[model samples]
Target: MKRPELVCPAGTPAALRTAVDAGADAVYCGFQNATNARNFPGLNFTPAEMEQGVAYAHARGAKVLLAVNSFPTAGRFDLWREAVDAGARFGVDALIVADIGVAAYAAEAHPDLRLHLSVQAAASSPEAIRYYVREFGVRRVVLPRILTVSEIKDVKKEIPCEIETFIFGNHGLMVEGRCSLTNYVTGLSTNMDGVCSPAAQVHYDKEADGSVATRLGDFTIDRFGAGEQAGYPTICKGRYHAAGREDAYYAFEEPISLNLATLLPQLMAAGVEAFKIEGRQRSRAYVRQVVGAFRGAVDQVLAGEDPELADLVALTEGQKQTQGAAGSKKWR
Candidate 1:
């Protein structure tokens, strides 16, 4: 099987260097603005930092992909446009985008620069993938974490561009680029603002019964027993009280991360061109540990040995991991 490129996350310049040093073939990051998805505080890079990061990665034989993936607001398209231009000027290898207008602007302004469709686009089917390739000249696509391995194989048969799949980190259940629950409570859009449950609005309170109540804005999302692990307060993964159920239960999805280390071979054989790690909101230490483990795993697979599963359970949300839809629809 052809070895898939390891495309890792780099929230900051430090994370970028850590990823490259740990064995990433390409590291993807974004500016500290709404142009990208992981717009959390203390994450992402400034233009100067991005330029330096690109240089550092290039010197180590790794590429840098700038993520300008969030959809641009009607009147604020220029910000997204500027981000793409800056990425190209800074010598990034590619721009991962979702918005059609952003893609058009990149194609018109930076024709030679590579374009990768972000998972936020939700272009899973071959026809949808072909449309992006034919219209925007997209060279790669980060497939959404919603398809099965067999489905991915079928998609590869029809699409012309390289396929990238997330193999680790947050497993989102809602349709990417389309979540608005955060906006409902906190008035901040994940698609446009690049933040979900912005940290400033997150609150935790101890209840009289020894339970911890997680709140996003004024709304109590989930409550956990004293001994249970409390997850980050996000609307989608939050529990709710309904239908006479006193204990709030996960109304959308559980707090489980996706770990597909065991499926590396299957993904490669299914024509996946790259493997993506999805934790730009995490720490440099996390970037180093997870990237290093995956590096060893991918190298082992490439060397014809059994790939070892990375010990990333502690890094997962709620200390739970799943293969996600790639393994089975039973997760749904």
Candidate 2:
């Protein structure tokens, strides 16, 4: 069995180094600007930082993938162009891109550069994957987390390029590059602006009854009771009043994270070429603990032993996790 490469996240230079030292086969991150997803404050790297990060990861026998993954809006095309140029300049192992224009630019402008299709493009089938491979020379496709292991195996059989997938991180439920819940409420596009629930528009208030109300701009996204855990203020994960329901419930999606630790062997059997760990906006401590744990898990799996992964659940979002659509075909 071919061992899948362990791709970890690097929100900052320190996080990059931490992930590498903690057994990351490759570290992926974005620039400080709004060109890539996870464009949060005090995160991402500067040009000099990216150069240093790439050098750091390369020196330690690890690779660095730069994420210039967000779509470019009209008249803002140069921002994405400059990001691709920067990736080539810094010598990133691959550029993960979503926009077709950006992918074409990378292919033409830097013929020697490697291109990996981003999940934001959501190209799930063999036909879709082939189109990107033929048109843009995409060396790998980050399959949407919405696929079952059986589905992934089927897709791999027909596709020509490598299949990379999110083994851990954001519940792949939200249609990548298609989510507009944030835009509808905040007047900012997560796909275009590279932000979901931008911090500038988020507000929290404790109700007199002791429940806390989390609001994104004018809309109250969710309210948690005194004993309940308050999750992130994103609109998709919030509770809402359904038309026929008497009370509030998770109208869109719940606060569960994507955790495929238990399915490592199945994923490898499904022909996943690479396993990506999400969370570039997380702390260096998070990188060390989670990456180290998963590193151990991958090593054991590669050695033909059962991977021990229960310890990593402490880091899951809202202390909750799910296999998403990877394990079960009937998963909603």
Best by lDDT: 1
Error of 1 at 306 (Å): 0.8
Q: Candidate 1 on 135-186: residue-level lDDT in tens?
A: 9999998898899999999999998999999999988659878998898898
Cα lDDT, all candidates: 0.92, 0.89
Per-model clash counts, in order, read 0, 0
TM-scores vs. true structure, each candidate: 0.97, 0.97
Q: In candidate 2, residue 232 scores what lDDT?
A: 69
The TM-score, computed over Cα atoms with residue i paired to residue i, of candidate 1 is: 0.97
Please give me the total number of clashing residue pairs in predicted model 2. 0
lDDT by residue for model 2 (81-132), tens: 9999999998999999999999999999998999999989989989999999
lDDT of 1: 0.92
